[model samples]
Target: MTDTATDRSTDPQKAPSTPPQGGQGVMARIRSYTPTLRVQRVLAMLLLIAQGGITVTGSIVRVTGSGLGCNTWPNCHDGSLVPVAGAAPMIQQIIEFGNRLLTFVVAAAALLVFIAMVKAGRRAELKTLAFVSGIGVIVQAVIGGMSVLLDLQWWAVAIHFLPSMILVWIAAILYTRIAQPDDGTATRQFPDLIRILAFVAAVCLAAVLVTGTMVTGSGPHSGDAGVGMEGRLEVDTRIMTYIHAAAMYIYLGFTLVVAFLLHRVKAGDAAKRTAWVLLAMIVVQWAIGLTQFYLGVPRWTVPAHIAMSSVVVAFSAFLYAHGRVREGGTGTSPTGSPVGDARLAASRA
Candidate 1:
């Protein structure tokens, strides 16, 4: 037996004296840096950043009147992969090319997220999020192409902006979900007043988005002269725009109230952080809106206004995700379904 042991020890490829269980072997070698739930969260956050970048770039294209620079969808001018050689001007080419490059980047990021989700295996919710984001990226690309092909019609532009905002929100929710481990208990709870404030804030944000679309549609920046029949702002348009602006002030007030409530309840660090972010975003957004209007819609201000709206939307989504019923129920998910209710109840107790 001693001689045999010596012979076995001489073979480098031979199994060790005690082989590990399959699961143990896998677990033992699992490095911390290996793809994990955290990686998925990071990827989701990156994808959101990319989405936000695309929105900003698209705004640049609009503000610069570069929407028509390429003059076609899925291709630049003259049917070339790059912009037309010396076509028009270099600035036009740069802006249009930059926008196109961003689209490709977003698509690539989405694909990476999909792969990460698949590798995550047992995380169903995360996998679903990745799937939704991937689908959203594809649909967004198609709609973007349609916008270009249709010469950036007002409705197309509105839908494009809206869906991208929604995608960002989805990404934000996924990030929060994955970043926090699902302890058997859920700690999300808030008073009735806080719930009402969150609801009002969300409604106000949506109203702001819709009305901003109308305002853009009515403005020269929309790139579509056909929006408002006969170039006249309809009563509906006026009403929506006013409501949208009014909603902004309402949102600002509600957010302040939320900040106060958050302070009163001593909500956890997460909720408090969210409240602060919401407050900052609300203040900045209001200031930007005023500046944009007073500045008479300057090209630079247009993108600023748009960027602020995106921030507000993201914050609103964060608030909604973190909101839990005080009676120990999970707040409604984006699709209006309850999640983590049982866990929340246990935590409340």
Candidate 2:
């Protein structure tokens, strides 16, 4: 009690510590630095692109018969983490291993954007989207390994591909949400009727994707040249193609209806623009599908077709998300009134 506290304050070893000039700690620094809207949007966009790009690379591994190039999961071969001489063809090993490596890249991008969202104190919806997207990358990696372990069976391969589309959709929505402020009220940009129509269109797109995968499963490419037609789906390729094409037409019809309604309504510019871009993507995909059907599904068209699939999914998600948006205005309540005004009124009541 005799000035002990004062002595402790003066003694460096006994004194309470102060944070460094920059920040208290690494996490504190990260939490203190809020990312700009532009930076956050860019990170979201990168995640979206990575989600889409990885699918195309996976297609490359399939079309080149390199699906089994590694011949194992979590490792290049039985013992090596990388390519080894006389293990597999150099090109196949490189293609398969490289595709696996890209999974990490996609995961890393998702993690960065997610961390940015958390640091920026984004809304729960945005954070959830980022979390799901990051988780999806890990799930996809596991599925990919399963496909290899199962000798690249048609169903396993199809399973691996479908989740990528879902991740793309999630990333697209995240990109849209990152532009909004955390405290803003959610507003509908279009009528509920139109939103319902968009939902139906999205469902049709999913059907198209599933049927298309079935077509590939039944077609010439069985991922591994050595597997040949043994593990392929037993369905006739022509029948599967017909089913896939029919699903595409239905999807196209529903999308056209959504586009028409979007134009009729005074939807936001972003919504209308996304609708048009989606239409264009659907048409391009149609052309590619036709080319693949007539040309016996060439190797080159597979990647193009897969890439366009990602684009279509992204734009479709963008259009749907435009139906409802966070107003990004100050102190707005869910009813579109100022939060302060509402609070004052409540106080008066």
TM-scores for the candidates:
0.76, 0.87
- TM-score of candidate 2 on Cα atoms, chains taken together: 0.87
lDDT of 1 at 130: 75
lDDT of 2: 0.88
Candidate 1, pairs of clashing residues? none
What's model 1's TM-score? 0.76
Candidate 1 weakest lDDT stretch, 10 residues: 328-337
Writing each residue's lDDT as its tens digit, candidate 2 over 131-156 gives 99989999999999999999999999
Candidate 1 Cα misplacement greater than 4 A, ranges? 1-33, 223-241, 324-349
For each predicted model, how many residue pairs clash, with residues at least 3 apart or on different chains?
Answer: 0, 0
Local distance difference test scores for all models: 0.70, 0.88
Model 2 poorest ten-residue lDDT run: 332-341
